[model samples]
Target: MNAALALHGLSFNYGDRTVLRLDALTLQPAETCAVIGPSGCGKTTLLHLVAGLLRPTLGTVSVCGQRLDELSVSACDRFRGRNMGIVFQRLHLLPALSVLENLLLAQHLARVSRDGAAANALLDALGIGELARARPAQLSQGQSQRVAIARALVHRPSLLLADEPTSSLDDGNAVRAIELLRTQAQSIGAALLVVTHDRRIRGQLDREVVLGGAA
Candidate 1:
């Protein structure tokens, strides 16, 4: 079994404040893993490092067999665009744009042509097709969360990293969001790694890992 994502003695910190002290964590292809821990346990930092959003201060992180430290800035940006999708805790949608527009913008930023039909298909699959024309500010928290998921999956990234994506939803909507994530991950051959403190969702995932430091 090939490991899709791996971390080896990875450590990061802000000045004297230590965060993300991972040691030899790995996830196989097609794996749907849940990361659970208390607040400020370095879950988000780990995700950022895995996604190439941050360079490690020590050790190494790799995804799809590519070592993050070895890639050039431009190469890393392209690699992330072509292979990674992220769902942030804040959703990060543009208030001025409709949901459909927000997704289109993401595709444009990735240098991919905006395919309205495909975008609609993705929205439909995520059960948010009807909300396409709605702006982010107008939707409920649950609705925005679904839109974020749809945007993340629209480009079919091979690795999906989510940070507290479903934390704000009600129980029913939380399950729905997870189901949508699983469906997209399965269809795209993407390994889904979600970081959250929600214990209720543990049994819903195929695997679970705890984030921590040696301290």
Candidate 2:
């Protein structure tokens, strides 16, 4: 079977400055890995590259056997929607929509059929079923984080990317959040790649990739 994610000679630069460089990286389906590094070490940049939000300045990123560099803009968006799920550091939930609507929107954007049952099931699994109709502004930080995670997995993506997933939680919640991510990703058979500076979660993952300080 093809690797869930593969990066070969990946390097990203901004003008004259180099931000990230990785000779090779790979993650098999249902495997879990963490990218741990300092503030400017391109942890988030790596996530974006894999998600196809930003193209690498050099080399290639392949997700689910398809090279991101080979896909057109529209095709890339579609592929990302169907094959990848991202829990951004900022938790970009729509304030105007209810929690359930946010998940439905993800499906709509991905061109997948809207399945309210699946959406609610994911919310319930995350232990936030009752909050499904609540607006983003009404939830606590931890609640909002869970909502964001639910949104990402609503479509059962093949690759799950999370950035700083536990940056705001206390020790207890941090552990719980990481466990939720791992359990959910495994259930969907997605490869889990987390970009985090939090050392608390390092031991929970299968392996860790430490990036050097910003170049």
Candidate 3:
């Protein structure tokens, strides 16, 4: 199967420091993959490259068969807005927006027509339907994470990238988070890439890519 995400001869640097170097990496369609490494291993950096938030110093990032490097900055942003879903550790929900409205904003930013029903359905699927009208400040940590996940999937993106998604939760919540991420990705037929150093999540994914120095 063609790769849902691919990095060829990827290398990234910041001035004098080289943060990441991958000869090749690819994630199959609907695959759940984890990128594991210690701090500074470029786990998050790799996601940034894939999402077009950062340009690779010396390689190409291919997503859904298109070369992201070939697109202009604005074009790349549009492509990501339309096809990618990113869940940050911070959950970045606008505190003032209700759960449902937060998701609507994602659709608007993507320039896609609003689909309130689809947004609500996603919230229901993520087990956050009851919190639809709740403000972000009113949610528990787990609920906040669920809202972030629902927001990411609200548009039914083709690829989902999550950074340290379960790092803040207790072991039990962490496990639930991983399962939710995996199950939801499968249901949506989207490739999932989670970057974290937490070994608790290792067993939940279909494949793993270990970054950083080898022993």
Among these predictions, the greatest lDDT belongs to 2
Q: Which stretches of candidate 1 lie over 4 Å from their true place?
A: 213-215
Task: Give the per-residue lDDT of model 3 (tens digit) for 1-215.
Answer: 55889889999999989999999988877899989888888999999999999999998999999899889999999999998999998899999999999999999998888999999998998888999999999999999999999889888888999999988999999999999999998898999999998888876899988998622
lDDT string for model 1 (153-192, tens) is 7787778888887788888978878887877887878889
What's the TM-score of every candidate structure? 0.90, 0.95, 0.96
> Could you tell me the lDDT of residue 169 within candidate 3?
99
For residues 89-142, what per-residue lDDT tens digits would candidate 2 score against the true structure? Answer: 899999999999999999998778999999999999999999999999999988
Give each model's whole-structure lDDT.
Answer: 0.84, 0.92, 0.91
Enumerate clash totals for all models, in the order shown. 0, 0, 0
Ranking by lDDT, best first?
A: 2, 3, 1
